[model samples]
Target: MTCRVVQWATGNIGTHALRAVVRHPDLALAGVYVYAEDKAGQDAGALCGLSPTGVTTTRDVDEIVALGADCVLYMPRLCDLDVVCRLLSSGANVVTTCGEFHHPASMAAEVRDRVVAACAEGGTSVHSTGSSPGFISEALPLVLSSTQRRLDTLTVDEFADLSYRDSPELLFDLMGFGRSSTDLAGRVAHAQAGFGPSLRLVADALGVPLDALRSHGEFATARDTTEIAAGTLRSGTVAAQRITVEGVRADRVLLRFRATWYCTTDLTPAWDVRDTGWQVTVEGDAPLDIAIRFPVPLDTIASVTPGYTANRAVNAVPVVCAAPPGIRTTVDLPQIVAALG
Candidate 1:
């Protein structure tokens, strides 16, 4: 059964997803939705560095809805609930890299209700997944917990060495990497919103619903002016940052997620920073310490990082399309088997 897939938003992650959809053996390119007017009427394949796919891209949302694609790979930078609801109400399943929908229970009641209504109306499913919260935080923890009869604590540590990342706007301006002072409130809120849901999902799966989710941010300043791929980090500027989100149960931290991102090793506090990868530590009856590393060179990491996020969403199309209509989480779906043939 060949599923018709729509490639939505040809950005970084979207570009990778578009290429994969075109090459997938069990999927056919149905339509493409682009936000930029310049991309409208362009060949989908040309946008993703592949041979022309004959499917022209359109900027109109109605045109995409009318295509009736079996699934839409919604990989936009920021999630728009209206657009997502529109797609779902039009009978197209959606598998997205957006972090918010990973756990629908974590969403506001009104927001969740709206999506539920949309799914009911069109008889379709919507799933949110990606490498970080999807794989490391939710899926991996659940697998490790299977070995334990007595579970104590599970921690997920994510490390990103952004020394070679060349996105000035993302690193310097948006993330405040090279800024004089870090915005603790903003970072904490963002971390809580982005990763708190994954922690809640894991806690719920373990049958220990959290009493509350707490988040905090810490930063280290540069000891000396350091030049990175993005730009120069002046002395006393924020050179390293760590955001931690924890799920508490019975007044104890049962699940924890920590993200450590750094552009240079030369910092006032001298924080421990590793190569781009993830570390999962499970402390229980069956203790396990696992490390997943990205061996790609730092210089070329920008070109390779998108697949980490995009591929999972691409592999999930079939599972999402086959799922019962609702907001599907990693727990709701079966193990995503990559259709690489």
Candidate 2:
């Protein structure tokens, strides 16, 4: 049976998800949810740079919900809890990359309970996935560890050049890009929200329960003002920031994920940004290190295979929709295979 899908937004990742939804053989694009007034009246196909699909975009939440889509590719600018809750209660399974409880297991008890209640009330499901806090940290590491009989430490790092990202507000304000290094709480909070679940996924996979989990954040300051695509980096302001989630077992770091993002020509105590987009190291049995690089071809809207994230969430829709209601994680689903040929 073909699963009906609604594209929730047309943002960086959403744009890719929209295209994938239209192409997936097992999925049908029933509706397109637009948040921006300018995008509301356009055709869904036009928004994704495709031929007319007869799926006109609309900002009306009621309209999309009324479409009775079986699954929602719920990517908005950010997580909108009210919207998510309402959708779950409306009997629609949700799969999002919006950094909203990607791992429902990591959410607070109260919030988790509410999601559970919504799922029970509607008999639906919700899942969250992404590229960084997602497969790299959770899925890939566990897959690599299958060969290792003994495992000690696992580290996943992502050094991204956000210059390719177009969201100025996201790159600057939300990320504290030009903010004072003295105050990095905002940036740290942003990373923790996403990384927490991925860390949990790793610990669960290894059958190791962490005694304590901690968030670590640090930043480097710019010696001189510099300009980048996202925004400007002023002297003395933050030029680079690192966010880490460490899962501890008996005082040793068993698993950890770190994301370092910067946008300057001069980095203090300089370190070269690894040209590889991602790196995963396993200091166990045979000691392994792996790096990944995606050839993000130059385009008007620069992105690093945003399709990777789109496919991550889209491929999980079937499993999430089939699962019992509540917060589902990577642990709840099997290996996701792409339906796009």
Candidate 3:
């Protein structure tokens, strides 16, 4: 059963997904959706550095809907509800990297209702997944918890060394690196909204429904001027930041996720930091400490990081497409078995 797939958004992650789809034995490149006019009319293969696949890319949503693909790999940087609803309502099962749809119950009532209605109308399903909130925060914890009958606290620590990432706009302008500490209310809220859903989903899966979700952020300033791939980090500027999201139940935190992102190691207040990877520590009857590291060198992280996100999404297509019509979470679907042939 070859599943027809549409590759949406040819960005970093999407590009990797496109290449994977073209190579997968059980998947066919039915269509390609691009956001830039320059990418339009180009062969999908060319966009992802493969031979011509005969499927041309398009900037039109209507064209994509008309293709009636079995599944759409939606990897846009930012998600659009309208586009998602339209794709769902058009009968295309969606597998996305968007963090919001990871846990449907965590979504706002109106947004959830709209998506539910769309799924009902088209008789399709949508799933949200990615490397961080999806694989690390949700999937890995669920797997580790199976070893314990009496579980206490589960913490997932994510560390990313962005010193070699060359995206200036992303590091400096967007993430607020190399800047003085200002009001972090917005950043805190963003972290809560981004990671809270995954935490809630994990809690619910563990039968420990959270009473509330709490989030906070902390930052360390640089001790001296440093040069990074993104830009310059001046002395006494924000160099490292950590955001923690907790799932609280019965006045205790049952699940916790902390993301520590840093551009430089030299900071006024030294903090424990690691390479780009994740550490999962479980405290229970069968306590475990596990570390998953990206062994790639810092210079090539940009080239290799997308696969961590895109490949999981691509592997999930078959399961998501076969799922019952609704929003499917990591808990709802069976283990994703990649058809690597």
TM-score for each model = 0.96, 0.88, 0.96
Candidates in order have lDDT scores of 0.91, 0.80, 0.92
Worst 10 residues of 1 by lDDT: 266-275
Model 3 TM-score on a 0 to 1 scale: 0.96
Residue 265 lDDT (model 2):
42
Which pairs of residues collide in model 3?
none
Query: Which candidate number would show the highest lDDT if scored against the true structure?
Result: 3
Better of 2 and 3 by lDDT: 3
Runs in model 2 lying further than 4 Å from the true structure:
162-182, 221-238, 264-266, 297-301
lDDT (Cα, 0-100) at 286 in candidate 1: 89
User: Per-residue lDDT tens digits of candidate 3, residues 70-132?
Assistant: 999998988999999999999999999988798988889999999999999999999999888
Model 3: runs farther than 4 Å from truth?
A: none
Winner on TM-score (2 vs 3):
3
How well does model 3 score by local distance difference test? Answer: 0.92
